[model samples]
Target: MYVPVSLLFFFIGTALFVYYKTQPGLLPETVTGDQVFPYFIVNGLPAGFTGLLIAAIFAAGMSTVSTSINSSATVVLTDFFNVTSHSEADEKRKMNILHATSVILGALGVGVGLAMMSVKSALDAWWSMAAIFSGGMLGLFFLGYIARGIKGSYAFVGVICGVLLIAWMSLSRQTVFHNYLTIVLGTLVIFTVGMLLAIAGSRLKKGN
Candidate 1:
């Protein structure tokens, strides 16, 4: 689904760019790639249709925002509260906590969104942050999936090393790695280190 959708979107975007470029005085040199679509929607489309499109955009944004807030709240409930199937009173308490978490997370999301207004490109900022956070997560997943008989200490060490590499790659301006490669490299590092440690441990045990 994503592949076809991405292909179609690419073609459509290509057509839009061609249309804008071929037309004289339609697009200004100062306009950026991020602003191109919004510029077209506001300047090219009819006012009523533009309003409808903007409303739809808001609707889509709200949908994703709600999903993120809900998911984050659920994670907090599971990880922090350790909520499980229990008595009715406990269930109710869990529900209340979830609600409170959702509200707090929603406020934080709004604050972060407002803070990001000064960024030149929202997408770039989002990708950078996503890469930084997702690296550790992906590394842990890879370590669990690929490693067998790896001790908890080995897994922890691998995850810590992967996280440090990701931080270095993201925070150090002199690093050559791209923002998107952080997750990939981090995952590989975790898996490789964990597997090697597990193998070494097994060999040492046999030798002893």
Candidate 2:
């Protein structure tokens, strides 16, 4: 259900996007790929519908931003400040700290968003960054699920290799792999390397 729904959603979206992009005079040459959809929504749609869509977009954005800020604040307080170890009376102090952290993080998030406005394509930039950063975690996930008898040290080595591969793929113009494939390749690399090392280790142990 989920897969089919997602496929349908993307299929329809891509088709409409392509139509809009290829249709001449609908969008100016100066309008970027990222700006095209919003521009269309505002200009093409009826007034009431346009307002509703804009409101929906704002609601989604606000929800996501709030969640991120809250999560970040929780991490900062729990991990760095050790707020959880505080006394019951200090709950007020913790609340104050959390509020302050959330405000600071939210401000930082706004700054980053403003900075990213200059980027050509927000979607492309996001995917590239996601691919680069997801490598280590995705590799670890694969190792945990697929690579039997693999020790943490060997897994760490595999993750390092995977991260390097992903980084090179993302940063180097010479790399053949696409940005979308980075996490896939990185996870496979980590799992494969870790499994091979584990097998070799076991073989050596048996021989010894």
Q: What would the TM-scores of all predictions be?
A: 0.78, 0.75
Predicted candidate 2: what Cα RMSD to the true structure? 3.7
How many clashes would you count in candidate 2? 0
TM-score for candidate 1, residues paired by index:
0.78
- The deviation in Å at residue 18 for candidate 2 is 5.2
The predictions' CA RMSDs to the true structure, in order, are 3.3, 3.7
Query: Which residue pairs come into collision in candidate 2?
Result: none
User: lDDT per prediction?
Assistant: 0.82, 0.81
What total of clashing residue pairs does each candidate reach? 0, 0
Residue-by-residue lDDT tens digits, candidate 1, 97-177: 899999999889889989987878765676677666667777677667766556899888888888788878876889888
Question: Which window of ten consecutive residues has the lowest lDDT sum in model 1?
Answer: 80-89
